[model samples]
Target: MNPPIDDRKEYSNNFLSTNSPIYERFSQHTPRCHRGFDLRVWLNNEKNLTRTTCFCPPSFYGDMCQYQNQRISLTIQFRVLSDSWSTLFAIIVSLIDHSKQRIIHSYEQFTYL
Candidate 1:
């Protein structure tokens, strides 16, 4: 026999839980809070259609907030030093901007003797 469904667990990507703060204050039904908008509307309002629009906050974008937005700039510098026994290896330097709307990702290696 098949197992019975569980009502406690919710599986909606678009709508928040019924107990969510936004839903409790602004909406009587589950609400959507992602992507480029936060949407809330009565599920039983088919007979009386209503329209609303909500925009996403900073660092958020896309139709369902499925992607992260960022801007990046990189700078690299190199230097070498000499030692009595042997020559010091080259050193690498990296500079990056980490603004609110920007992300920095990088990888590097350095060696010295």
Candidate 2:
């Protein structure tokens, strides 16, 4: 015979419970400032694999930490300031072969405000 199930109790236990303070303190709470930028990069190849993230402080250029993998091709994503007076930016992705210290396949895009 099958055992009886407590539907109400089970439903309550399954629900997720949390407080704002827990999330606020531990998580990135503030909206990113216009001058601040973030970068995420990954490297994958037959020789080696790696992943890196960089946070650029205000008015910085390129990857903040210059994360690189010598044996793999890397993929980079980032935003940067524009040449216009308005608040503009750019986003780019490129495959970098750190073994040779050069870019293999790359796509760059720019936007104006």
Candidate 3:
């Protein structure tokens, strides 16, 4: 005759629970914030479709690629920080033209450190 399933629990001395501290530590490292940019694209021609894409260097992150209609706008925002300081270094904004494939306007500011 076979014993019940619960009877096996007595043979094992060590049992792990779900609310362990290890579980908490794993969740803490997950990504909680998202940073990026918004760009606006205005196409000159109606028949031609325009596509825009952006590339970010090291220490930067944002939305790089986007599609446009008649008047398309994208916002790009990134967090800049210094190694020794615990504050933001600057903010950058880039306005691109998808139809012409070029940057129309670019701006940057370093107000706080």
Candidate 4:
């Protein structure tokens, strides 16, 4: 069987025309929406302006996404022995239920070297 030819393509801005909007970059800096995206602003032509809506994440809610939802944060730290300096470790941390059977509610794993 004959071998197929392989063609490799390099990325470039040559595909865009000289008059494209990619050249004339706008400098309008919009305010951030805390955790989410696009705080939309509406401005009537000859009337009033400054109407906006902040699209916030599920963890936050407010007119300007200024409120934060309640959450629990946990931090874990580990130390390695001098004898096993080059050893790689897979660490699993779990949350268990209080019962006769050790029911695991949640778990997270971390790789250490």
- TM-score against native, each model: 0.27, 0.21, 0.22, 0.32
Query: Which predicted model would earn the best lDDT?
Result: 4
* Model 4 lDDT per residue over 41-113, tens place: 6677677675667788889988767899765677867687888899887888788868999899888898988
- Model 2 ranges with Cα > 4 A deviation: 1-85
The per-model lDDT (C-alpha) reads 0.59, 0.53, 0.52, 0.70
User: In terms of TM-score, which candidate is strongest?
Assistant: 4
What ranking emerges by lDDT with the best candidate at the front?
4, 1, 2, 3
Q: In candidate 2, what are the lDDT values of residues 11-104, reduced to their tens digit?
A: 7665644555665566755533233444434576775776555565534444443333334355655554566456545555556657765867
Better of 1 and 4 by TM-score: 4
Q: Residue by residue across 7-105, what tens digits does model 1's lDDT show?
A: 334335346876779878876654555556666555566687655555766776655565677655556554545446476566564445568855445
Superposed by TM-score, candidate 1 places the C-alpha of residue 51 at a distance from the truth, in angstroms, of: 2.5
**Which model, 2 or 4, shows the larger lDDT?**
4
Tens digit per residue, CA lDDT, model 3, 1-113? 86776776754433544576876787676332232233335565676655544444444445642322233366667565556566644565555656766867655554555
- Write down the RMSD of all candidates, one decimal each: 14.9, 19.7, 20.8, 19.1
Local error of candidate 4 at 46, Å? 4.7
Model 2: how far residue 59 lies from native, Å: 37
* Per-model tally of clashing residue pairs: 2, 0, 12, 0
